[model samples]
Target: MVFEDLGIMPAILEALKGEGYINPTPIQEKAIPILIKGKDLQGCAQTGTGKTAAFAIPILQRLSQNPLQKQGPKPIRTLILTPTRELAIQIGESFASYGKNVNINHTVIFGGVSQGAQVDALRRGVDIVIATPGRLIDLNNQGLVALNKIEIFVLDEADRMLDMGFVNDVKKIIKLIPKHRQSIFFSATMPDSITQLASSILTQPQYVEVTPVSSTAETIAQELYFVDMVNKRDLLLHILKDKELKSILVFTRTKHGADKVVKLLERESIKAAAIHGNKSQNARQKALNDFKDKKLRVLVATDIAARGIDIDELELVINYEIPNIPETYVHRIGRTGRAGQIGKAISFCDSDERIYMRDILKLTKINIPVANEHPFLPAEGNTDLSTAVKPKAKAPLPRENRPRNHAYGSTSKGGNGQRKRENSF
Candidate 1:
């Protein structure tokens, strides 16, 4: 159904149209009505499902209808708490886009960057505050943010927050806010812990779920490779020989692993970048922007970035390192194959990682076609990693070794019009 049918006002409808948003996503169709009616909502949906607009639009409408009429600093009426700074910034962008006609002021607060700008924004007074758990609590403790007047509270990506060990902070925030506030809770998965958290905050909440994390989209073709750990990098380089695989998203399990992938690809003259927890905020954002603009063809990232990356036409995702968590595999591949676009996910499973792959397949309930003839295929017959039958894996042509200490201060591109990794975040 269209946004018009979901009770959105003309001004907000015009704003949505400006963003080229046409039909409502399923979550928007189901949750928007309930939220607009001032009801608590529990939404269990994964990223790329357009869940942000489901609540953003209605809140914009509600705030516009009853504009705050105070002359002093504007009390924050809405608070959106997300797990990562990227997600919080993206949510802020959504609010700015959807609330263009609503005349509301909002600021995003997160760590890793200096708090000078954030503190200034908070002191200047904002109608809405979208923040991460740590930065929000820090500001609250410093007496810069008072949430007692929050009317609409949003606990987004609840599961991720808890996974990041933000449960106590979340509880503290909840206790500070008025209990009568309208709460909107959403998680990609509904584990028992997430359910308990939702129950604590939501009052008779309407439930709507879509795109559960365990299921992969049918449009994505999953390919598996049996390469040993040392040869996994070689398998990645071998796969990159295909010129058709443009704009690839590579996932690694550790921050150092992501950096290593970027270094290997850069030495091959293959443009790449890495984003993880340790990278400076500017570096991570710049790398992500470069990838999105198609200046960079490949982006290597950790699971912290698994969610909240909403790139259009992203079609290839390579898992250089499979995650132990089965659900993360879903989130990783879900980055591609979005908007019904045909996507491909290539996973390299070493003998040690076969158990992880097995759990992923079992969770998704789909058989991934394995590639047995790859150059890096373990020399031994392809067998379950649990079994002690393995041979050597192959690699591509040799590359001279080079030392890496620091080089995140260049933004120049060369070699086949590919954007080189000037700064490996």
Candidate 2:
């Protein structure tokens, strides 16, 4: 449905139209009205679902309707906590973009850069603040910012925050804010911990869930390449050589791996960048900007680095390393196929990662088609796909080494059909 149908202000609707957002995403459609009603909400939707706008629009409209009372320098009326600096910046941009026509002042704060600029912004007084948890805590502790006057509190990417070990920090921040304020928590996955956290914070909140946990977008075409780990880089290089790959996001399991992947690609004369926890905020932002501008061919990132990458027309996502957590597989592939656009997710799985691949399939309930014709595959030399051997099963240990006693105090008899002692000790 259109944004205007949600009862958004005419000015806000005009701003959305100017920004080319004519219709609301499913999450936005379900959330905007409830949010405008000034109620707490718990939203479960995957990334790239326009969740930022869902809350931003309603918040701007609400704040514009009831202007904050001026008491000395105005404290932040709205606080939005995100897991990463990139997401904080993105959410801030969304607020600024959608609230441009409206009379809302917003600022974003995160670490890895000078606090002087952020301090300046806070000094000037902003109506809304989007920030990373650590930086928010730091600014609060320094007495540069206060949350006591906050009217609305948002925890975006709640699962990612929990994954990054921000639960305690989140709790601390929540305690600092006014208890009576409206709270909204949005996450792609709702594990038990997230559920418990939400229950503790929200009071009779409206629950909006558009997708199941650990489920990948249906528009994505998933495929797997059974390649040797050593040849993964070569396979990636070959894929990048294709002219069809417009903008690619390559996911590595570790920060070091991301850096190495970027270095390798650069050595091959491919323009690429890496973003992770180790990189300074400036470097990460520059990389992201370059990738968005299409000046960079690829962006290699760890899961954390890629947490809030919302790029439209992202043509592909390559799993340089399969994630151990099945849910992470869904998040990684979600980098592409965003905003209802068709995309491709290609995974490079070696023999050791076959089990990981299976777990991902079971979680997402989508069988990724296996491709044995990739250049990295041993059978690629022969066009006959039948010659490719299936992955071999791991050999079992010797019989003597096997555990003799069962948990039920029973043991398998030998050829003599005799019972063994329950305990070998």
Candidate 3:
């Protein structure tokens, strides 16, 4: 259905047309109506599902329809809490684009940078505030921000927040807001932790789900390559020789791994960049812009840094390192095949990571055809899919034993994992 049928205002409809968005995505079609009614909502959809517009459009309409009397500067009427600075910034951009003609104003604040400018923006006043949990709390504690004026509270990327260990901070922010406000919780997957968190925050919320985690986009062509862990880099370099696989996104599991991949690619005289927790805010933004503009041939990223990445006609995604969680595999591949474009997702699996491949196959419930024509294929390759050996069952690693590449949270088992937020600006 078209966006007009979803009750979006004329201003937003015009803005969307300028942005070349005529039809509504499935998530947008279902979630916008409930949210426009000022009802609490719980949405489960994967990345690249246009969920940002689903909420941002209605928010702009509501705030514009009910204009409040201004005393000095407008207090923040809506608060949107997200896990990463990238996603927070993207949401703020969405608000700006959709509300350009409206009277509402919004700003985004995150950690990893000096707060002087953010504080100055807060002082100037805004109607909507998009922020990461840590920086928001820091400003709130310093008496620079106030959430008591919030009429609508949004917790975007709830599952990612749990992955990043922002539950306590989220709970703290929830307590500060007025309890009578409307709430919206959106997550890619409803893990038990996210479900419980949604239950505590939402009051009789309406549920909307689209494109379950187990499914992948039909436009994507999936393939797998088996190689030794030591030769994965060589395999990647070899694959790039085609020159047709332009603008590829390579995923690594850790920050160090991402950096290592970048260095290796550079040594071969390939123009590439890395985005992760270790880079400065300016550096990360520059790298992302370069990749999007086709200045760089490759962009190496970790799972967290890649959450809010949206690029058009980005047809190639290479999994340099497979993720441990099966659901993560779906998220990684979903980066491509976006906006009605056909895409390709190629995965590199080493001997030790075969178990991960097995789990991914089980989760997607489809067998990925193996590409055996590559030059870097392992000597004992092409094993029987049904008889692949699983990793030996063992106790989880201790906190100190697990690698500390992520910005926040530990390698702990319980979802109560705690870590610092806003490591990357």
Candidate 4:
């Protein structure tokens, strides 16, 4: 449906036009109306669903339509809590773009950088504060920010917050805010934890689910590549030989893996960059900007670091390391095939990660066609899928015995499990 039908104001509509957004996605179509009514909303959707605009647009309209009495400085009227710095910054940018003509100002609060400027912005006053829990709490403790005046409270990427061990911090922030505020909760998936969190935060919220939690987009063609763990770099290089993949997002399980992949690509003179928790904020932003500008052929990132990455017409996503969590596979490929556009997801799987592939296949309930057209077959040169899962000469290492690389929330073994909270930042 067109945004005008969704109750968007004329000025915001004009702003959207300048941004090239005329129609709303399904999530936006459903969630925007309910949110514009000022009702508590619980949205279950994934990345690429345009969920940001679903809430951002309504928020700008509401705040603008109901102008509050003039005060000395703007108190925080809205609090949007997200998990990562990247997602928080992206949300802030969305607010700026959509609320340009409106009388609202937002300051993004994140870690990995000094808070001097963030504090300055807060002191100057803002109508909204889009923040990560840790930094917000830090500023709140120092009396630099306050949320008691919040009229709208939004918890974006709730599942990711819990996964990143920010649940306690989120609960703390909720306690600090007005309990009577209109709560907006959005999560890619609704596990029991997310369900309970929503129940506690939202009061009689209207449920708007645009997509099933377990499924991938039908517009995406899924392809699987079975290769040896040692030959993964070679397989990736071979795939890059296809110049048609003008821009590719490669997901690695760890920061070290991401760096290693970027190094391999750079050595071959293929422009590439890696983004993860370890990289500085400026470096990460530069890499992301480069990738968005198509200046980098490959942008390798870990799962958490890739949050809130919305690239227009991005058609390809590569899984350099298969994730143990099947649900994660859904989020990864969701980066492509955005807004009903056709896209492709190519996954590289080794014998060690066959279990992950099976889990993903079972969760998605679709047999991903093995792309055997590539020349990365084994010594036997067979294209059989089961051959990769066949018996091996040496037994696999136990989870504890394996060397682990901490990417974003690296657990005892590896992968995007839970890590410590962002307390210091």
Candidate 5:
């Protein structure tokens, strides 16, 4: 349905028009009306589903309708808690963009940087505050933030926050808010823990499930390359060299791996950047901004750092290393194929990652095509086909001594020796 039919105000409608958002997404269509009614909500939709606007628009409209009159730097009236710094910033941007024509003051806070600026912003008074859990707790503990006046509380990406071990922090933050306030919980998936948490926080809330749990977007072309670990980087470089690949997102399992991948790509004179927890906030943001502007051809990111990357027309997502958690596979691929646009997700799987691939297929109930003939795969005679045979389960190696079969070489070994070990192990 058109956004106008949803009863959004003239200013908001104008803002939407300027932003070229004429219609609402499925999640937005269902959740916006329910949210505007001032009822608690439990939203089930993946990232890039326009879920941010679903809540942002309603919240902004509600706040505008009932402007706070508190004198000294109006205390925070609405609080939004997100899982990662990047997501928190993106949500704040959504609020700013939608509320540009309306009169609303919002600020975002997160760690990985100094707190002086965030503290100063809070002191100046903001109507809405978007923050990561850790930084939010820190500010609250330091008496810089006041949640007693909160009218609406949002827990965005609740499942990811829980996965990042923020349940205790979330519980503590909830206790600080008034029990009478409206609470909203949005997530991509609904595991038992998140479901139980939602049940406890929401009181007869309007339930919205635009997409099924553990499902990937239908527009993405999913494929898996059965390649030896040693060749994954070379294969990635080859794909990046293609003139058709305008922009690409690459996912690695760890921050070090992401950095190493970026370094290797740079060594090949390919413009790339890496973002993860270890990077400074400015660095992460710069990389993200560059990638979005097409100033950088590739961006390698870890799972946690890649949240809230709302790039339209992202054509490719390369899984440099398969995620152990099946649900993460869905999230990684969701970065591409956004807004009904066709995209491609290419996953690199070694002999040991077959089980991980199987688990992801079982969870999503979709069998990705096996692409064994990709340039990333070894020559026919070079591959050890015996590794694929059953009845000979390989024994697990010690974690420290385990082969570094990642997208880039690790410190455990260097040069061609590591490649030899990777092929033989």
Candidate 6:
């Protein structure tokens, strides 16, 4: 349904229209109404389902209707706690975009950068504060932020926060907020710990769930390659050669793994970048922006860093390394096939990672089609499933001793742009 039917204010509706937002996503359609009614909500939705707008729009509308008159330089009326700086910034951007017509001011605060600018923003006063837990607690400890005034509290990516070991910090923040205020909670998946945490803070919250993390989207074509660990990189380069895999998001299990993937792709004269916790905030943001703008064709990222990446036309997600957590696999591939668009999730599984692959299969209850016709196919074992794909001629890999100076160019004629249709069963 259209966003207008959700009772969004004309000002916020105009801003949404300016952003070209037409229909409300499922999460938005369900959660917006409950949130606008001044009720606590628990939303279980995966990344790229427009979770930002579901909460941001209603918060902005609520604040606008009852403008804070206790103004001594606007105390924060809404506080959003996310797990990462990148996500905090993106949520802050969403508030700015959706609240432009509402005349609400908001700022994002995170660690890894000097608190000078964030402190300045706080001193100047803001209606909303979007922040990461660590920096938010640190600043509050230093008496820099006054959160007692918060009326609307949002704990976003709750599972990620707990996975990142921010449970204690979240608890501390919850204690600071007024007990009677409206609280909104979101998580990709909810474990018992998350359930307990929600019960402690929320008062009979309305639950809204869509596309549970255990399930992958039916629109995404899942492809698997059984390659040796050493040859997984080659498989990636080989697949990229098809030129049909445009704007790919590659996931690695570690910060170093992400960087290594980026370096390996660069050696083949492929433009790529890596984003992880170790990278400076600016570096990570630049890499993300470059990938979104299509200046860089590939962005290798660790799972935590990839949170809140909302790219609509992202067509491909490559799992260079399988995650130990089955649900993480869902989150990784969910980056593509967003907003009802068809996408592809291609994974490379080595013999050692077979267990991880098995876990993912058990969790999703879907057998990812194995693409067995690649050159890097493991020589032995059941790693390469005997699937129905007809074996095609193998492509030659560049010699290890070859110089890395060959420049790559965009090919006018590439493989058919059609996505491979396989029974994902």
Top of the candidates by lDDT: 3
Candidate 3: what lDDT? 0.80
Q: Write the per-residue lDDT of candidate 2 for residues 1-425, one digit (tens) a residue.
A: 68889999997887677545677878899999999999999999765566878998899899999986656766789999888765664565566556667777777777766678788888878788888788789988999987888999999989988877889999999999999988999988888999999999999999998854567888999988887778988898998899768799999865667878998999998899998655655677799999999999899987655655688889999998887557778877887888889999999876556667776777777767888666678443332323333343431111111232211101111112221111100
- For every model shown, what is its TM-score relative to the native structure? 0.67, 0.63, 0.66, 0.66, 0.65, 0.65
Q: Higher TM-score: candidate 1 or 4?
A: 1
Tell me the tens digit of each residue's lDDT in model 6 across 1-425.
79889999898788677555778889999999999999999989866577888998889889889886664787988899988765665575566556666667788777766678788888888888888888888898999999998999999989988877899999999989899899999998889999988888799999999975688999899998888888988888888997876799999866667888889999998999998655654687789888888899899987666765688799899999877667789988998898889999999887667767887898899988888788887877566433313222321111112223221111111013311111000
lDDT of 2 at 298: 94
Error of 1 at 208 (Å): 2.4
- Cα RMSDs of all predictions? 9.5, 17.3, 8.8, 9.6, 11.4, 11.8
Alpha carbon lDDT of each predicted model: 0.78, 0.76, 0.80, 0.79, 0.77, 0.77
Worst 10 residues of 6 by lDDT: 406-415
What would the per-residue lDDT of candidate 3 be over residues 1-425, giving only the tens digit for each residue?
78889988898788677555788888989999999999999999765577888888899899989999757988989999988765665576567556766777777777766677777778888888888999899999999999999999999989988877889999999999999998999998898888999999999999999975688999899999988778998899998888887789999976678999999999998899998755654677799999999999999998766755687888799999877667779989999998788999999987667777898899899889998888888877655556556544331111212323333211111011221121211
Task: Tell me, by TM-score, which candidate is best.
Answer: 1
lDDT at 367, model 4: 88
Question: Candidate 4: minimum summed lDDT over ten consecutive residues — where?
Answer: 407-416
Task: List residue ranges in candidate 6 displaced over 4 A.
Answer: 70-72, 211-221, 226-235, 242-345, 348-359, 369-425
Stretches of candidate 2 above 4 Å error? 69-72, 212-222, 226-234, 240-345, 348-360, 369-425
How many steric overlaps does candidate 3 have?
Answer: 1
lDDT for position 166 in model 6:
90
Query: Residue 167 of model 3: what lDDT?
Result: 91
Q: What TM-score, to 2 decimals, does candidate 4 have?
A: 0.66
